[model samples]
Target: MTATTDESAFAAENAFGKGEPNIAYAQYFTGDSFLNNLVTDPECVVGVHNVTFAPGCRNNWHVHHATSGGGQVLICTAGSGWYQEEGKDAVSLTPGVVVFTRAGVKHWHGAKADSWFSHIALGVPGENTSNEWLEPVDDAHYAAL
Candidate 1:
């Protein structure tokens, strides 16, 4: 489905309730999305968040970097979505599918054109862990999928 189509559908429930507004840094995403931090305690080594993407919503290419070890893991919890690493084929995401993106990889993920999707993103902690958000995915490239 094209991102601009009118047939988009949203499931009754997409995992844990769509938490608070995303409040993502404006430069990081191309469309609407939300983020719900699930593990914020200082003692927790892993950061957990529930991300909900509106139909056709997607973030820009980014990387989770760490000097030794650290990356990001996305566990699909509801609806449908897509994930793609730089120079790799786009992967369909459904409930239970897990995408583990190792550190230093450039990747992007979001809801499909016609579906609202949700997933739990686990942030693996490591020395000097940081996120680097890059350019948005172009429309032509995204529509080709």
Candidate 2:
């Protein structure tokens, strides 16, 4: 192992990497809504992120790999949203609603098609937690919302 020393590099900070367009994921899931992932803990630590959905927005199908042994938790902070597991009906997720995702379960979630939504997402600290980003839910699937 290479020996390393602790250091701090503080530069002029202006934003929390939010001003840019469609930066977190890669493409727009729904309108301007996107995911801001902060994988601070590589393993044995917690990970955090935020999902902000604009009016008439949603997200594509995706899954989270267990880090150590836990899954993910989503705390709705503003507006409204929804969460559903694979092969299950969508559940309503509004302000004050907390949702937990099962480890290694394939699922998708986002704001209601007609409302803006924002939520803080957190995952358990584990050994090499991974994320599998799947296909975007097209208009056909979104129209059903």
Candidate 3:
């Protein structure tokens, strides 16, 4: 399933509060990770989640899609991490960095081998929004990063 962390670790490393970690749904991720629902506004078409990844924790390749227009944005709020799209070089993540994975792009994001990481995940709302989860990021691929 999911992993738990000592709250102090995040408190010292992150700019934002590392709210209680939610059991990262098994259907979506690989290794250990947690989620904090920071904001959910259905009316304004916006939602934000704080996600924490212990060292080496990551999710599988996935896609966010919408019939009209929508995708996902990640605002790095703490520590170090990695983000990669299918067939592209992995980008390093740190505080103040923002990543925009447009709808229909296959990608994955997670912590580095020796560092914990957190990001504020923003959901860009659109009609017919949905997520497509695919295979895990292989160990070999990650090890090289």
Q: lDDT of each model, Cα atoms only? A: 0.83, 0.64, 0.82
Q: Please give, for residues 71-124, the per-residue lDDT of candidate 3 as tens digits.
A: 999999887889999989999998888999899999999988877789999889
lDDT of residue 115 for candidate 3: 75
| lDDT value, candidate 1, whole model | 0.83
Best by TM-score: 1
Distance from true location, Cα of 9 in model 2, Å? 37
Residues 58-88, model 1: lDDT tens digits = 8999999999789999999887889999999
Screening candidate 1 with a backbone cut-off below 3 angstroms (N, C-alpha, C), the clashing residue pairs are none
Error of 3 at 34 (Å): 1.4
Q: Which sections of candidate 1 miss by over 4 Å?
A: 1-11
TM-score for each of the candidates: 0.90, 0.72, 0.87
RMSD of 1: 3.1
lDDT of 2: 0.64
| Per-residue C-alpha lDDT of model 2 across residues 1-145, encoded as one tens digit per residue | 1111111110111112222345666563756755566565566366677676665566677888865676788887665567777788788777678988877887777766656566778876556788887777667755675
Q: Point to the candidate with the largest lDDT.
A: 1
